[model samples]
Target: MADTGIPHFCNDLGVTLIEVGSKEFMCIGAKPPFDHPHIFIDLGDDTEHVCPYCSTLYRYNPALAAGEAKPEECVWHDDPEARTAA
Candidate 1:
C-alpha cells in the first residue's frame, strides 16, 4: 500500500454522521475483521457522502485536520505489520 495520503475512516461506533476532515477519503464501514470494502469516497462539490456498502454517512468539516474525524475513533489507521503477519 503506497501511501496516497488519503484519509481512512470507520463506523464501528455506529454514529449517524461521521464528520471528517477531508471531502475525499476511504470509508472502511467498520474496523478490520468486520469491515466492508474500503470504498473511495469523493464528495466532489458536495459536503456529504454515504458509503454504498454500509450506508455510513460522512460529512466534511474544514476545521478538521486531514486525518481527523468528529468522534476521533472514526479515524482508521491501517496496520501494515498485521497484514504481513497474517
Candidate 2:
C-alpha cells in the first residue's frame, strides 16, 4: 500500500508520531473497532500532543517533506485478552 500521508490509527503501534503542517490536527483512533470519536487537537506552541481517546502521541517533525505524514499499518488484533495479558 502507498503512503496516504495520514497518521496511523492502529493501537498496536502504541505511540504514533505524526508530522503536520500546523499545530492543529484531528484524530479518529483508526477505523472500526479501534475507531473513536473524531476530535480536533490544538498543540498551540507545543511540538507534541497526545490523543485523549486512544492516547496516541503525535509530534511535529519539520524534517518531513511536504505532504508527508508518519507511516502506519492497519492491523487488527482479534484477541482482546491477549493485549491485557501482556
Candidate 3:
C-alpha cells in the first residue's frame, strides 16, 4: 500500500505514552526492518489511542505540529526513495 501522507509514530524506546500532533496517523510499532505492520490510528474526538500490536499509548496535543511527537524520536520517517534497491 502507498503512504497516506499522514504522520507516523512509533515506540521503539518503549515510552509509556507518546504525544502526537495529528489525531489520525500511523503507528509503526517501530522503525522498518524491526517494525510491525503499520497500523492506522485515529483519535477522532478522543484524546488518546493505543497501538494494539505494540500496546503503545498515544495522546493528542494541539500544541504540536503535524508529524511531531513529544519524544521526537517516535516520529517514523518512511522515505521510499531513500531505500536501496534490494
Name the top TM-score candidate: 1
Cα lDDT computed for each candidate against the true fold: 0.89, 0.57, 0.88
What shift in Å separates residue 50 of candidate 3 from its native position after superposition? Answer: 1.1
How does residue 58 of candidate 2 score in lDDT? 71
Ranking by TM-score: 1, 3, 2
Residue pairs clashing in model 1 are none
lDDT of 2 by residue, 1-86 (tens): 13434333344455456555445555667654567886677777898888888878777667754334565343222355665686
Model 1 agreement with the true structure over 1-86: per-residue lDDT tens digits: 45889998999999889999898899988888899878999999999988889988899999998889999999888888987799
Q: How accurate is candidate 1 locally (lDDT)?
A: 0.89
Better of 2 and 3 by TM-score: 3
TM-score for predicted model 1 compared with the true structure: 0.88
Task: Identify the candidate with maximal lDDT.
Answer: 1
What is the model-wide C-alpha lDDT for candidate 3? 0.88
Off by over 4 Å in 2: 1-16, 65-67, 72-86
Q: Count the backbone clashes (under 3 Å) in each candidate.
A: 0, 0, 0
